[model samples]
Target chain A: MKRIVLLVAAVFAATMPAASAAGPVDITFLHAMPGPLGQALKQIVDGFNATQQEVRVRAEFAGNYDQLLQKTMAQLAAGQRPDLAQLEVSLVPRLAAGGHLLPLNPLLNMGNWQDFWPVFRRQATLASIGGTVWSIPFNNSDPVLYYNRSMFDEARIATPPATWDALLEAARGLTQPGRVTGLGLILSDIWILEGTIWSAGGEVLSDDGQHLLLDSPEALRAVDYWARAVREGTARVYPDIQSWQADFAAGRVAMGFGSIVSWRFLQPQIRFPLSVARMPYISRPAVPVGGANLAIFKDIAADQRQATWQFVEWLTEPAQQARWAGLTGYLPVRRSATTNPQYAPLLNLPATPSLKVGIDQLPFARPRPTAPGYVQVQVEMRNMLEQILLQGADPRGVVRQTVERANRILAEEATR
Target chain B: MRKARPVQDTLVLLVTAVFAAPLVWMVLTAVKSQADVYMGPLWPRSVHLENFRLAWETAPFGRYFLNSLVVASVTTASVLLTSILAAYAFARLRFAGRDWLFLLALGTLMVPGEVLLVPNFVTVKRLGWLDTYAALVVPFAASAFGIFVLRQTFRKLPVELEEAMFVDGASPWTVLWRLYVPVTLTSAAAAAIFVFLGAWNALVWPLVVTGSTAMRTVQVGLASLIYDQGYNLPVLMAAATLVALPVLLVYFAFQRLVVEAALQSGLKS
Candidate 1:
């Protein structure tokens, strides 16, 4: 079968006519949104194009965030930069380290910079990069607790757990032998783990941003809290995020932690009642933001730069963001968009799992660690958790080792 | 040996099941509704053929198919042409450092394609071919794999065959097109098939080079369904099944030739 791959000659004209330069200041945008999400983004871009005549934005889907970064860097190296790039937040620090990102502060003259969700602003900013925001938050989301409402009722629970201790207890009660595992733990993203650490009054990174504090007493406590549930047979670690969502939709797991955006993928498959609530905290209520950001290159034409900024600004405006949030379940980067008339329907959206809780928890939202090497470090943190929860390894020992490895990576990144 | 036949047959069935499981699963998922996808019976209790229609409607897949068809076809043709010429010269023609140059061409295969991705992309951009078919087809036009296969095939041919052609007043070009190429049909076909497949399945390079939807390919469209949220497994599976159909048909039709041609390349080497 592999041998016969595309053997015959294609008679159709292969050469696509290059985009003409005669349009209204044609500019390119590289993004990572896919499927309906890409459609939503395209719709918004189309609206912007329809309403304007000075500049035309051509948005391109460049695989995913990692792929987008590669394309952006390659194009930047060739001095053929895309007008805009949608980058994941952690990627901003590494890209800014390349010194090719146009620091957004100078281009963003609008007063709406402050109107963006503070979490998003902080998420897209790097103090080490001259305290400048390198990217603007676009498709931002924070983790929330997703649970089976039917199982909670069956367990005779009155409300979803509000604290870490209560969550563990609920997991213990919700467990029906040979039926439902209480919680399905996602071992991919460190945002949930970081949020948990913060809720335990511990920080994932130090104030100086020089080290990971995962080995700190509070952080270790947070790790142990989840690991304890796993050891008790009330929870199980899912190999990946998709599997966790699938299990929850299948009613195999009573509870799980996922982003506000997960509902769009899970709601169509769910058969039982579901509920979303604030991320349960060990000590206090806090959540870490996760999602992609929009950035621009440093060396675009002056007119193109202004035009690109105008498009970027238009994309993040309250009205467009509200529509984007409605079409796609991504949280709007701007606070004003949540209160926009279009966003009101989603807050009380008719579904077993509504994502309004993610917005409700925004006041306590914080940014994840965004060091140049943090992307690599996240793998270590996730691995450590997977070991503890899935393999019954001792949490304290794993935490110490993971923190040491993380700091070493950060040190190497700093020197580079 | 005769008594062990049943055990071997059982083993073969197990291996076949292992290989066929995913393909079977994909077909089932394509027909299953969203409700059945997450939790229902392994063999779907109900089938929805409209799932394919829904998957097709979700995005501009028809446009993607056209792009992929054009890109793959143009690329495969170019690769075969270039490889035949290069391989013929390397195999039959006398030149200084002949073996060394062939070795140098072959050494390119040793470097991971990913390592060359950035430099190649930069070069393509500088050449002002970005978003054109040339950017997609030209860079992959001359593959070391294709050259190696054809060269091996050409080298294995008795020298008297080419000498006999030249004795009959055939030019090197005629000897190549009329004599060498047809005589080496099996290996060349193998090389063409392999080259076409690479061009067809490519995602990252094509995604980076082309910017507009009109230039997008099926693989890119498939990749777009897979985002941070997760796959709509049924729709994604349906689209994948649709994408696999033409290739499956081609493979089944050329099954014996593909195997024979592949064997020819390996045996000559």
Candidate 2:
């Protein structure tokens, strides 16, 4: 029996590293960036570690937002909570509802909190979370128009369209009879849909976030605008992002909509002169802000909370944000980060594709609806898009039915 | 044997092509340049083999390969050990509720592995096995599928041989390992392949369990290449092709043995 105990002890000793001598307080950060993006994130964390001696931050890649959310929930269930978590904007509502988030209002100073882009500040303090800032914006982005310059020139258009109606007019002129498609329609991405509905002055959810407002006349107009373009053979819909991007790069389409960060991937393959602009609005300029935010969970060890907040504050600083944006192509959360010396290279990157437009569009951005039930409601939205765009169903009746079904799904979730 | 007809042959070829298309695309994309992947012809105008080099350098693929090889090999061996002993006890040993226990053991097969993920993670964490090889290998050290396959193979053997050996003053261990193992080698190989592949291609459980770069597997390395929003297609394809090569080689080397064992041994009771 003693021999068996010794053997088990030996195995454990061999597997686990020795406990470190007491020094700096260590806090774990769970983030959703992987690949080269993850490596860039590492630099920010390493930069913080180098600047201070009180706290040591260890960051780990938790896959994408969906995967990171799953791992976070599992960790929470296991009582193995990380000190900090970077969650997607749409998912923050769900986390806030879980009651595990430490409301960030108390830890933040007014000046630091106020320095974020106005759109991001609005996004951070969503109504669904009781108007308290549950998370601070981190790697921010906004979808914009990336177009072929030669196609617009050949069509005798001097400037890209500034509104949805104008875009249709431009598409009519730019689309060649049997050759070039005007727009690469992306209906499946709920972010683009959110921007379109908001631009048309329609709400996806009500003020209280208890009911669906997608059946409004304004939302129907947004859907109808795209339907008209597709029916005229000026627009083509691809099944997924990669296929659409491939076709766009191949010059099959005159213009496409993608997040500003995707420029890093798309620009490398474009063999023609390209242009970037804000997402054309219907009534007024509005876009859906993309990317994740950092939050301190309520379950963190009390002593570790201060250290974690310090890490968050440091990451959002202009210098750190500038360095991060320059390395990863994620938009800096702070408006001041754009003009920092570190950001100069990105602004002047040889043949740089509109570095200022992403920052300029920050004031007009809105996050996807922050209702906890909207995640489940997204499935119904996808079905609505498929029906209207591909099946040619009337947006009026389809929109109403989608709202009814989505409300039922949301109601079921609310009860659960 | 029935002679092949043109329609049937064409149908078979079409089905084979359907299965082979993605693999062919993976290899073609792995060799092509980034621009070629988007706009070039079906075949590359110029093969840029440097994509493989880029993929290899993107991560510490050497460490990843070693970790994966060790985990898969050790897990496969442990599973075979537990499965053989479990099968023999149920097939030959006389005990209370032996058949009932065997039925209950097979009952575990009805539960999907995903349902057990959280509970397994909690258990491993409590055991201080996180970020360790034991965490990767120990929970999967025994598989119900492995036991079922080996048990079925064992039951197919003539029971009279064991009985006769026992009467002649031979021990059960000698009869089992020395006699049964030699004849059922192909069946054992079949079980080993499934266990090996499962351990090799694992993603979520392994990703959650192990956090350190030193302990990561090759699948995690491939996943890391697919970053935010957009990934480089040729580079991703190159990494995927490298990750899949070992499994393809293993399957090819063991194909005839598993096929013969499945055919020559009566698969049905």
Candidate 3:
């Protein structure tokens, strides 16, 4: 028995050094970005795995933004949390506040933070809770107006609309019964609705993050103006985001307002000539940035934390970032990466040149407010918006009630 | 009873056909080419059997099949053992707050499975059982439904069996093994099959805890394929067909046993 035990111990000791030499730290990373973006992530993981003998990073697709939050919460509760997760830019505050994520500031400084773009630097810095950088920006994209160019030509429109009035006129020109609608607006997606609101110089919440500003005149006017497109005979509003995308792709809609990352899926299937332009502005030009950022989960072992950091840092490198951006249609986060010679030719490609439209808007892009209980609050807000747009709920009264409810949610979250 | 039989039969057929339509479409789509899929009608223009082959080859479906089979079988066996022992005690054995304890066990049925997800995950993680089959199948073995159903099955059994076993110098375990289990096998089979399906198709917990592809079950594998590949309808349908095949086969093979067990368990009390 002693000899057998010694033999087993000897075998284990012999294997231990080889495993450590191979950098045997394994990391689990969850990301909301899927399809081409997920493929890009896989390539990054493959590259990381090939380059090192020690740390092995594995990528898992954790559904879309809302699902990722649900899955992550469950995992955290189960004590089976991932090493790193791709959180939406706006959800960072709650995760950080809950002490579920590790702040990236110390790690960033240790890893030479000079190469990142100023916009990302500012945006990432702002998203952190209590001046702690809990997440690093990845796959940041802004909304753009994608148009079926053949439909535009058929409607006798020369160029895409650059202003709200022109957009309205274009919609009027494009609308045809049983064939097509002018603008495909999804009433259920609050982010799209807020894009219109922000473009119209409206605020949904007070800048302090403590008050509800939905009752403000500017906010009311923004809603009323948005309702005009549906209220008027020019266009149709979709009950959900999927229908909007489907209608646009099926040639039932002349224009679609979606994320720049949509080009990854849209470009591959579109049979008609497609073009992109900046989303039309009302009072001011504004586009809410929507995409995910990579954050390290707290409570992991130190080596696993290092492995996670290594993967994240490598992912943000100019060459890999540019490649990922090209593949996924996500705007490259690093300024140098966007300008890198490697990306220029791909950006110049005709079928997907539209990707540059969103890249150009990064300087003006800002994130939605991140707060605890935002998911429940957003669901209520979405229901309210959908009710007004689709169900013909009283816009003024519903808006008032929603603001009150949202404020209550904020107050409840504040106490926690 | 047969006065208006034709209309009722037609109506029943129509409803059944409508419900079966999606499954039929799934089968046809699985064997259809991309062109046929894009054309998008109720049926394929021509069969493209290569889709199933391609989807099967794309990942480790063979390993996934084996893993799922082993996990489901182990889970069913464990649940049967635990539930039978617990159920016999609850049904026949006298203890302090026995009724209260049984009620508490049954009361857990009211709580949604999602609420227990986090605490169960934490328990598994603390035990360092992540990515292991034991973690996936073990905790879930002690099920409330199993205990409740088996208890019902045990109570319905003639008390003479237990008395006879005791008179012959047999203990509870001996009685349980020799007589009780044989009599209650049908109810136990019903519970085992239900738990088997739950464990086989489980997504949330496995996706949360396991990191490696080798550790993934068929459901997670199919989900990841869809997410990774851009809406390739043919390939997705093929993958779905593959995932459904085992469950379908199991049902067909034991259709008689399953039905008999289910009816006996339900009608007993």
Work out the TM-score per prediction: 0.91, 0.91, 0.86
* Ranking according to TM-score, highest score first: 2, 1, 3
Candidate 1 lDDT tens digits, B1-269 = 35668888999999999999999999999998887887799998988888788789876899989988898889888988999999999998999999999999999999987788889998998899988888988888888898998888888888898899899999999999998888887777666666767877898898888887778888887888787777688888999998888667656766777788766655632
| Per-residue lDDT over A55-173 for candidate 1, one digit per residue giving the tens place of the 0 to 100 score | 89888889988888778777876778888888888888887887878998853466777787778777766787788879888888888888888888888999989999999999999
The i-RMS of candidate 1 is 1.3
**For each prediction, how big is the interface RMSD?**
1.3, 1.4, 4.1
Docking quality level of the chain pair in candidate 3: incorrect
Ten residues in a row with the worst lDDT in model 1 chain A?
Answer: A9-18
Question: Which residues of candidate 2, in runs, are more than 4 Å off?
Answer: A1-22, A176-179, A339-354, B1-13, B91-94, B265-269
Give DockQ for candidates 1 onward, in order. 0.53, 0.43, 0.23
Q: Choose 1 or 3, whichever is better by TM-score.
A: 1
> How far out, in Å, is residue A43 in model 1?
1.7
Candidate 2 chain A, run of 10 with poorest lDDT: A346-355
Model 3 lDDT at residue B266:
58
Residue pairs clashing, model 3: A22-A53, A22-A54, A23-A54, A78-B121, A78-B122
Residue B13, candidate 3: Cα error in Å is 1.6
